[model samples]
Target: MGSNPTLSVFLNHMFQENSYEKIIQTAILTAYPRIFTDIPLSKEIFDELERIRKTESHGEITAELKVSKLAPELEARYKLVDQLLHKNNATQILEIAAGLSPRGVEWTKNPAIEYVEVELSEMARDKNKIFKALIETPPNLQLKEGNALNLKDLQKSITHFKKDRPIAVVNEGLLRYLNFDEKAIVAENVRALLKIFGGVWITPDITLQKLLQVQNKTTMPGKNQEIIQRTGRNIEKNSFKNEEEAEKFFNNLGFTVERHSLLEVIDKLTSSKKLNISQKEVKKMLEPAVVFVMKLEDSRA
Candidate 1:
């Protein structure tokens, strides 16, 4: 073989295959959540991601922050995480497409935080092995494998731990791979879970098509970076179009959508920063990508 190609170029090749999406997602499962290590679990989650992406298939590393995906923006995921977690009084988080990153498990300083991570069957195996080496107490944390749409699979996994508690659900980089039916099915399950258990923290992002049009893309590593470069994996994206549509989509599904963006959340989380954008500025940029914190409409003091 000739000299090893740069990792970025290799990733571009691997994603050209049929299972490129899975491979890319698995890579993201490994990366994509470390921007918030200010929270303790964020560091643990970051470490877990580092371990999982070490696979030869995910991609090669030419540069330090070589992975790529959505937002294509700065690492402000913590602000997103913090707002959702705090608003719901979230104690349990069921993270779907949770390859190996442990943000849900690692970011919580709230002693009550418990995370149930769900990944596909193959990634689950690697995730479990990595998870075992990373934690001693398994009470606040659990990782299981299954299709996101299968409640039976979720049920089996849920049986292993506390069955009765309000659980917040996390979905990151999941909507792109799911069709409308799949999305609806998962939403139904989330509704079922929250209705039974107590909470749902969902971020259904704009489609891949719409995301690409944005100017301030996060050059951050998403699972698909390698695949996109190699296999010509063009992600299909849909525009959120506008806040009205975005808000209506989730609202119909039973969540109260507080439409904000990464910057808004960052402003809220970081009190003192000259680099911070003003409220009007963040609100303006939010036209393309905004954050929504949803909770049960009926809940009241």
Candidate 2:
């Protein structure tokens, strides 16, 4: 399918045209090679991004936000998700809003795993080209252009899955951009898929408003403001008021939630030593982040 120009224009305006946050994230991971080791395509993609648009260095961006430890926090989040996927023994995975993530590429290395990465059309096209250039496109790794809010798009991506096996639906940084209503649509869509495929939905994007308030006072004072100014998304406004509210929101949608602290995988972060980040600092950086592994409430019975 071709790129959706209307949606592209809307997202460009929302994100200040050419300043998509994922590109910055890719740049940060690319800057610290030792920390985010496995993804060989990150650097190439970052270089391509720079050629396409002007971008500030990750160091300057992190320094401005006073979140120099963001890299380690990102690394921890990525690794913890992988750990949980393995723990769940999920062989079929669907990653929504896949962005510039290297997970599909790495996971598909094991032929037994079937990975599908869903993204907006433009990014899907860009990522497809990059993947093909860096290595032979694995048959198991399919990149589909789709929106999380649209169940039809999501259903198209899963057609390749074997209905006999449970699937794992995952997303890392998608929900913060959506308002409550949009988030509910995504939840419902995932619930529908789980009902059909019998799998769990894993996401770390269930941020809390209270946590943002606390971080604004301490670890990342101006970070939220900076993000709002850049992306036009008020994350605090979009976040659940607290953990209780977050849990209730999911529970109401018929999901059973399992919270996993990002700190659980702190020991696995190689960036801590390379970046000279102390344990105290890493803990503070990760304290607010949680990866929720959610299953249909009925599935637990």
Per-candidate local distance difference test: 0.54, 0.75
Per-residue lDDT for 37-101 in model 2, tens only?
33346556645544443432422333352344456766777889999999999999999987777
Looking at model 2, the pairs that clash are none
- State residue 46's C-alpha deviation in candidate 1, in Å: 6.4
Question: What is the overall TM-score of model 2 with all chains considered together?
Answer: 0.82
Model 1 residue 38 lDDT score: 42
Number of clashing residue pairs in every model?
25, 0
lDDT of 1: 0.54
Give the Å error, residue 250, model 1.
2.6
Residue 216 displacement (Å), model 2: 3.7
Best model number under TM-score: 2
Model 2 regions lying over 4 Å from their true place: 1-41, 51-68, 214-221
Model 1, span 1-301: residue lDDT tens: 1112244443443354554234344344335334332434444545565655576355543353433222223234445755667776776677777764556555444566766778777777766766576666356677677767667767666654456777777776565554444455666667677666766565635443334444334323243444444434334332344567656665666666665566655444332232343545433333355555666655422
For all predicted structures, in order, the TM-scores are 0.67, 0.82
